[model samples]
Target: MISGFKLDWTLISPVYCKLRWYGLQFGVLTSFACTCLAAIDQYMCTNARLEWGQWSTADVAHRLIIIMTITCLLHGVPYLIYFNLVRAPIAGEISCTSDNLAFRQYHTYGYLIILADAPLIMTCIFGLLAHNNVHQLAHRTVPLVNVL
Candidate 1:
């Protein structure tokens, strides 16, 4: 018993496993939040009157679509890669106080984060589609009343 009590591998392993899972969940949540923020900022820039310009409604929608696409590329993609590299492998190996286990859990968290960002990418795709439809409508006829 290295730690004063008889070391129980079965008892400890489950705790480590849970910690690793929780770490993964945390990472996923963090990544999702970052993605959402980027998308929301772009949405606001495009649909809200937060920017300094007297853009026509069509111009606003066009700018928003462009901004959202750029933000997705610039922020979401790298975050996904970074998270995967740092967090994926130790998905169920972390422990409460074990250093090696903790490291693995942390890495597993990084992976989950990247995986979670998939939804944000999808959101960006849909946003682009919606923006394109609006743009086309603007050209062909009266613009939609609400473009967001």
Candidate 2:
């Protein structure tokens, strides 16, 4: 959230002339993706039973970190290329903006996919799976009756 605030501020701040759009994009996407990965991890952990072949939380976390890093790097390339601080003709003020129209549209679509679509879908899927797993586990457990 703080990264998001910084990105928002950088876009609007008049005094902030230079913007590292790649870093900003990478940070934002990585943060959000990692958050979703964490939710998936929680669901997996909750559903895991005492099995020998099951993956450990540490293993899962490490894999997720690697995946998130690679994804962020891949997605951040366009921001690195197209985003720059330019002076507006009418206002004579500098602001962060994209250079190429086509690339900008592609980048916008990428953001929508990564930030909105993927997260929402993943969250719902994991949440429902976790709920069902918990319900099933609860039903399978035998309730002890106390007889005095």
Candidate 3:
């Protein structure tokens, strides 16, 4: 909202620029990770194997979420270090960009793969696995008869 008013905090402060990009990546990655974790949790819970079902407990879910949160935060640290406000000579336009050339390239390509496609693929895989597991529940120790 502040940015909508043309009072961009990132433009005013370098620290804000760093933190803005860092927080953006952190939030995006964390959301995707959590969603992937949920899909895996569903697969675990639906598995016919008792050992796999045991891992679907609330405690395990909490731990996994925490681990993912920390991992995403760590992954975003590079954005904090690399992203900065760069001045363009053509029109004196300032843009938020990465300082390192390699990191910039990675941000473009790697972000698409790591932050976009990977999670969707993981979610689809585990979702299908869970569906298959549900179908096999009828063969487990506790019988699950198909509904008419």
Candidate 4:
């Protein structure tokens, strides 16, 4: 029984090791992509106000404030939840890390919520693309059949 238990751990160890490797890869790539999106949003807002040079400093400031607020709520919070909550827990389990365990538990629920919203986001993106396609076609003439 002791020998079998030891063999089981040996087998399980590799599984956990692979999980940790994949988790870190997933987390890093996801974080980098999100950072790129944040940068893009910042760039877009700046270009709309400063590059155009029509808006006053107050107007630009207000726009930036709104953009930053929305991004923090929509992107930043969810990102932290995904990283410190979902990815970190799985990673910690694999590595047997006790540090940050409390933070991980606190954020676990956010991961559940984030997973639930994934489908909604996909639906919204597809709907937007379909709407845009219809709008583009509206300017073009299509052949129609007439029945007397």
Q: Judging by TM-score against the true structure, name the best candidate.
A: 3
Residue ranges of candidate 2 with Cα displaced over 4 Å: 1-19, 48-53, 87-94, 143-148
Give the per-residue lDDT of model 2 (tens digit) for 1-148: 3376555655565233234667777788888787787667657766847552155368767987998799788877766566777678999976677768897787778667877888889888887887887787776664532322
Write the residue-wise lDDT of candidate 4 on 46-143 in tens digits.
Answer: 34244543443556656765664454344433222333212244545433222355545644565445444543464455455545555545544243
Residue 142 of model 2: what lDDT?
42
Q: What is the alpha-carbon lDDT of model 2 when measured against the actual structure? A: 0.71
Task: Give lDDT tens digits, candidate 1, residues 1-148.
Answer: 5377877443455444444444555555555655654554444445434342244355655676666555544443322333221223457542333235554575568545556566668568747854765575567555454553
Candidate 1's displacement at residue 8, Å, is 14
Q: What is the lDDT of candidate 3?
A: 0.87
- Candidate 3 steric clashes: 0
Candidate 4 local distance difference test against the native: 0.44
List residue ranges in candidate 3 displaced over 4 A.
1-4, 138-148
Candidate 3: tens digits of C-alpha lDDT, residues 1-148 = 4757878777678899999899888888888888899899999999878998999999988998888888888998899899898887799988778879999999999898988799989999999999998877745635444442
Better of 2 and 4 by lDDT: 2
Superposition error at 95 for model 2 (Å)? 3.2
* C-alpha positional error of residue 70 in candidate 2 after TM-score superposition, expressed in Å: 2.7
85 Cα displacement, candidate 4 (Å): 16
